[model samples]
Target: MSLEAPVVRGVELADDRTPRPVTASETVYEGLIWDVRRDTVDLGSGTVRRDFVEHTGAVAIVAVRDTPGVEGASQVALIRQYRHPIGATEWEIPAGLLDKEGEPPLAAAQRELAEEVDLTARTWNVLADFHPSPGAMSEAIRVYLARDLAEVAEADRHTREAEEAEMTAAWVDLDEAFAAVLAGRIGNATAVIGILAARGAKEAGWVTLRDPDAPWPAHPAHR
Candidate 1:
């Protein structure tokens, strides 16, 4: 017996923003960066109560530069920062929360790149966007592919504090970073997603990327 591929049907491969009715909602706990919210949602079949993190969304950067003397290869900046929740220092790309009021995603990404890594990029493109954990959090993240890099001037650099004060940075080959993700050496969700997506975009001749200012309708804050 032989089986054929299943018939494909859809307008396009994209996620829809369908919000369920919330009968009741309240903040269960408010933290520094996010809050836990409990809501009674009408699921059509039945109503269910659930608690999830109310995030402000964030942005990440895959700052890449051509490897000197290497053909068709690049190096991406990675930072090591201690995460209290995980109790471990993980390798991550420069990223930050969108806590500032009325900040665009691209602007946030640029700010994070400079603050976290002391670098700037002349070219930027949207590599990918995703919800880190849609089931338990409303944290939407947009990762950008940043190239044509340069260091931020000393006088203009922002002062670091807390975990960022002790953070360390390294420039690694893009392929090596992707391998680290596959090998589980790198566990930061945003880092893993950004590296893999950057590699995929590069493989596709960077045509798969969107403009840096592309509309992001899936972000909770944006919606």
Candidate 2:
């Protein structure tokens, strides 16, 4: 199972422009996002065969509404979208992949929350970074907890439906969201991870999410 190339860092070589041979029949089969390509790498005394994969970056975020519930539960905002890839309606926190040219993670998160959920967050804190599917996809999801949210003036209507496939905004509690995740209602990994992270951040008080100027416990806290 050990298929790593036995090459060292900064291998001594005279001709840097010299190209190595790529064996055509080294790998078994190829897979999307990555190929099972094998090649015999050159070493001092021997050549070893190996295979590896490449990746591109991605990002995700949990845009928490942070509203108090009627039943003493904490509420978190979410979105319902029809994911054509999975062919099932999915509920997830606001998230998207990084720009092809590579943009900042938090900036992308903020953009996504605004574009998808119609809310822009003022305070943002990075929660975690994870490789949602490292085996094949070049997807690296950056999770963030956005707070101090205010609704945007409007959203891009064109991408809201079919292109994005987002139906409507849905808000649920942390416990309920987690329960849905457990019961297979929340199927997106980004939302699950981001919600769990947001829950932790909320507990730690790093996210004073509600409007600071508003009267606490009666405005959005007690409602």
Best by TM-score: 1
Candidate 1 per-residue lDDT, tens place, 103-178, comes to 9889999999999999999999999889999999988999999999999999999899987899999999999999
Alpha carbon RMSD to native, model 1: 2.5
lDDT tens digits, residue span 88-132, model 2? 878877777664454555566677777787777777766755667
Model 1 TM-score?
0.94
Cα lDDT, all candidates = 0.92, 0.63
Give per-model TM-scores: 0.94, 0.64
> Which is the leading candidate under lDDT?
1
Candidates in order: C-alpha RMSD to true structure: 2.5, 12.5
